[model samples]
Target: MKVIIVGYGRMGKEVEAICAQRKHTIVAKVDPVCGDAPALTKELADQADVAIEFALPESAYDNVKLYTELDLPAVCGTTGWYDRVDEFRNLVTQSSIGYLYGSNFSIGAHLFFKLVARAAQLINPFPEYDIMGFEAHHNRKKDSPSGTALSIANIILENVERKKTILTDKCDHSINESELHFASLRGGHIPGIHKVIIDSEADTIEVSHSARNRGGLALGAVLASEWLKDKKGFFNIDDFISERLKYTQMI
Candidate 1:
């Protein structure tokens, strides 16, 4: 399969290596910095089987739109522009394109997401336990409260009834019980780390996920592209995840 990789940064490079290992041809890379083709031509688009995108937050909107223009299926890992997801959905729906995106593209992270959700559901009846979480990522990372953390926050919010909102700010004063303080810490070289805490006067329960490197994300992105190749529609990574998990359950 011929692939067009968007974003020529660390993650993009990682995906490139994985694509090579998996024997997928890279037809083009769509980044301004190091990519050979900063923009896709009809020739390149027609030759490309799929596009895997890991560009900047600012570039995500336009990059994904370009995929629609080319009728290319895309698997995007860039974050922080989801406020315009409605626009993306409309474009994919109208153009009959396939677009799948997610905050984290690690299978382990998805498993961790499920673990956190189950823990939150189990702890929901215990009102005495309070819940809060924090995430730490490499200092150079652009977005605070990394998209993975927000996804986890959403999972917790969906499962745990008491928490109505997420608090990403520094709590200068005592915070309300209904507020879940999901903090973000930027530091040296930490790839990613997220921990959800359920605490009370008696005991503390914590579920955490840590990334050693970008390998998991790279593999997952490639797998997502393979799943999306013949499909058309807007989808989250969880759709792919859920479909695979269902087959496992059947077995």
Candidate 2:
């Protein structure tokens, strides 16, 4: 697979290493020092089979937009730009481009989210089980709650319908939510840590996904790019795992 790396910073360099190890070639890199969207050439755009975006939230929109406009596939690992997700979705749908994005690309994180969903469903019947989410990441991370935490919380909210909203508890009744709380911490060089804790008068349950590094995420992105070669449309990790998850249900 030939890839164009958007964002030549830390994650981009790490992704380059993974692509090299997987026998994939990075034909070019898009960085702010080089040029913005208008500087991207049609030839350079056409050269890549897919683009892996690890750019900042502010820049991610333009990077992904470029790919979609060129009818190229894209695998995005950017966070904090969800305020414009609807626009991105529209671009992908209209162009018939293959676009896949995730808050965190690590397989463990994906499984962690699935587990949270399942647990939420199981605990929905028990109103005594109140839930709260917390996540920590490196100080350099832009988003406070971490997109992974938000994703997990959203999944939990879907299964446990009693919770109308997810927010940090500051000892106030602001949002009028009954049973959900979300909190975040950012410090050190921590890769990532996300925990969902359920508390009740009887006991407590906790599920977590801790990312020690970025290698696994890079691997998943490469695999997704490979899977998307001939496909066109928006997708996510679940699309790749649907068959495996179904088989697991049988067992």
Candidate 3:
């Protein structure tokens, strides 16, 4: 497939390398430095089967809408554009285009989320325990708490009846027993760390996923590209799970 890269920074470069390893073509790259207004030329636009976007939060909304408006399927990894998610969904639905967005594209991270959700469901019946979330990322990272952390918090919230909300600090006021605490730390060169800790009178249980580098994310993005090639409408990593499991069952 001919893929256009919308960000030529760290993640975008990694995506390019992964595409090469998979024998896929990188047709064009649009970086922020390229120009102001930062629009794609028709020639570059014509060469793409899909566009893979890993731009910054500020540029993500415009970048995604541009390509999808042009009727190209897009797989986006850029976070912080979620404030306009309803607009994105509307655009995708109206255009009959495909848009797949995930906070983290690592296969391991996605699987970790699935496992955490199931575990939360199992542990929810026991009222003695409560859950909290913590995340760490590289200092250079923009978004705090990381997207994967929020996803995990959502999983815990959905399954655990005790947590009705996620907070950044310990609640001084009386909050719901089921509420989740989110602690975010930014330091060093940490790729990502997300831990879900369940505390109780007896003991504490923690489940976490740590990323060594960008390889997992690069690989997962390629897989997502392949999955998006023939799919239409809005989707997420959750859809990939059942499909992957079904394939595993067949094999």
lDDT of each: 0.89, 0.80, 0.81
Lowest lDDT 10-residue stretch of candidate 1: 242-251
Tens-place lDDT per residue, model 2, 73-130, is 8888887787788888888888878998876678788878878988899999988888
- Give the per-residue lDDT of model 1 (tens digit) for 1-251: 89999888999999999999999999998788899997777788899889998988898878777888888888999877889999989888888778999877899899899899889999899899988999999889888888788888999899889999998989887988788899999989998999999899999999999999998899999999999988999999999999999979921
Q: Give the higher-lDDT candidate: 1 or 2.
A: 1
Q: Which candidate is the best by lDDT?
A: 1
Candidate numbers, best TM-score first, in rank order: 1, 3, 2
Model 1 clash pairs are none
Candidate 3: stretches off by over 4 Å: 32-39, 170-176, 249-251
CA displacement after TM-score superposition, residue 85 of candidate 1 (Å): 1.6
The superposed Cα distance between candidate 2 and the true structure at residue 223, in angstroms, equals 2.0
RMSD of 1: 2.3
Please give, for residues 175-249, the per-residue lDDT of candidate 3 as tens digits. Answer: 567568888999999988888887789999988899999978978887898898878998876676558977888
On TM-score, the leading prediction is: 1
Q: Which regions in candidate 1 have their CA more than 4 angstroms from the true location?
A: 57-59
Which candidate do you rate higher for lDDT, 2 or 3?
3
TM-score of each: 0.89, 0.82, 0.85
